[model samples]
Target: MTITGRCYCGELTYCIESEPIMKGNCHCRECQYFSGGHPNAFLVMSDSTFQYTKGKPKTFTRSDLEKPRTREFCGNCGTHICTKSEFRPGAIVLKAGTLDDMSLFDKPDMAIFTIDKQPFHHLDADVPSYERMKP
Candidate 1:
């Protein structure tokens, strides 16, 4: 399935050519601060299948975890667009909220980094939840 999305200001546009291998909500502190919310959903696509169409995004190297990861965002509105990992080899995680037709993707299968989850928001018990990043 082809999925398309754009940044809040419409300056950055993207297209993904395949179904995401995984989708989930991330509740890590970095994600919370980046999204300004409790959790942010992501659709994981192959890096080779994801393409930026409109403009180049401003990138920030946000972490030095097991893998070095960079976040790409619209410079104009500072909309978090996607996260890429140099160590992951072939994957790109796109911020689901940026999708123009998000309904096209299945509901997220799980939640990750729940150890940092906000205290007030409860998640559904049916989905598998992880204390830290999912493997």
Candidate 2:
């Protein structure tokens, strides 16, 4: 089944031709900074199944180091969209909140970067959390 999403302003949209590899929440310092001080929930899918169906987005690279990941966002409204990480080849990280019909997706199976999770954010005991990225 196809999955679709759009940026907050609806300027940037995308389509995923297949199911995601995984869904998770990231509380990494980088994610908190980019997501306005909170964890970012997203779907991890293959690049082969991803497509841009609407306006172009501006990209921001995280880390100048060897494995820099790129984030794509709506240029018009500055809405966060997706990410591409060299660390995880063949995968495209898509922001969950941007989904056109969020009900179709399941709850995140993992919570990454728990070491940096804010004190106020209480994670469920059963949500499988990791101090760093999911293994």
Candidate 3:
């Protein structure tokens, strides 16, 4: 399945030529901060099938972490686009909200980092949830 997306300001665009390897929500503190106090819905896609179709995105990797996940975002709009992790090489974690068709990620396959999930953060009863990262 081909998926097309762009940043909020349309400064950066991307295309995913393959299906996602995983679809889930992350409730980690970092995700909550980036997502404005909510769990981050994401699609894990193969790096080989993803490409920037327009302008380049700015990237950031926390200097404090020994092994930090690299975040890619629109420099102009500050839209969180995708993230690349050293632990999950060859995979790009795309922010579901950035997709042109948001309905494609209607439900998460799982909800992770629940240990850090806030009291106000609600997940569907049927959505499998993990206290931390799924093994």
Candidate 4:
């Protein structure tokens, strides 16, 4: 199933060739800070199968304890688009809200990094929640 997405400004567009491997909301402090919200729901796609349909997105390599991760966003609007890691080769996590048809993806399987989750946000106890990245 091919999926289409665009940046907030619609200046940058992308297409993914396959169904996402996973979909989930991340509550890590980094993600919360970057998104300016509770958590970010993202679709995991293969880097090789993801293509830019319009304008090149500006990329920034995040510096942290983990391996370097590259963040791609619209240069004009600064809409956070995708995050890719060489360490996790072939996988790119695309921000789900950016997709033109977000309903096409399955509901998130779980929430991660709940240790830093916002106090006001309440998640279902039934869903698997991880204190940090699952092993």
- Per-model TM-score, in order, reads 0.91, 0.93, 0.98, 0.92
Per-residue CA lDDT of model 1 for 22-105, tens digit only, reads: 899889888888878778889888888788899999998845566668899999999999998875669988899999997965
Q: What is the lDDT, from 0 to 100, of the residue 7 in candidate 2?
A: 87
Ranking by TM-score: 3, 2, 4, 1
Q: What TM-score number comes out for model 3? A: 0.98
Scored by TM-score, the top model is: 3
Q: Each model's C-alpha lDDT?
A: 0.86, 0.86, 0.95, 0.85
Tens digits of lDDT, candidate 4, 1-135: 888989888999999788788888899888987788779888888888889999998999866647888899999999999998875688999998898987865578788999988987677777788998766
Q: On residues 19-104, what C-alpha lDDT tens digit does candidate 3 reach at each position?
A: 88889999999999999999999999998979999999999999999999999999999999999998899999999999999998
lDDT of 1 at 18: 88
Q: After superposition, how far is residue 51 of candidate 2 from its true place, in Å?
A: 1.1
Q: Using alpha carbons, what is the TM-score of model 4? A: 0.92
Clashes of each: 0, 0, 0, 0
Better of 1 and 4 by lDDT: 1
lDDT of 2 by residue, 46-110 (tens): 88968889988899985557878888999998888888887889888888889998975578898
Among all windows of 10 consecutive residues in model 3, the one with the lowest summed lDDT is 13-22
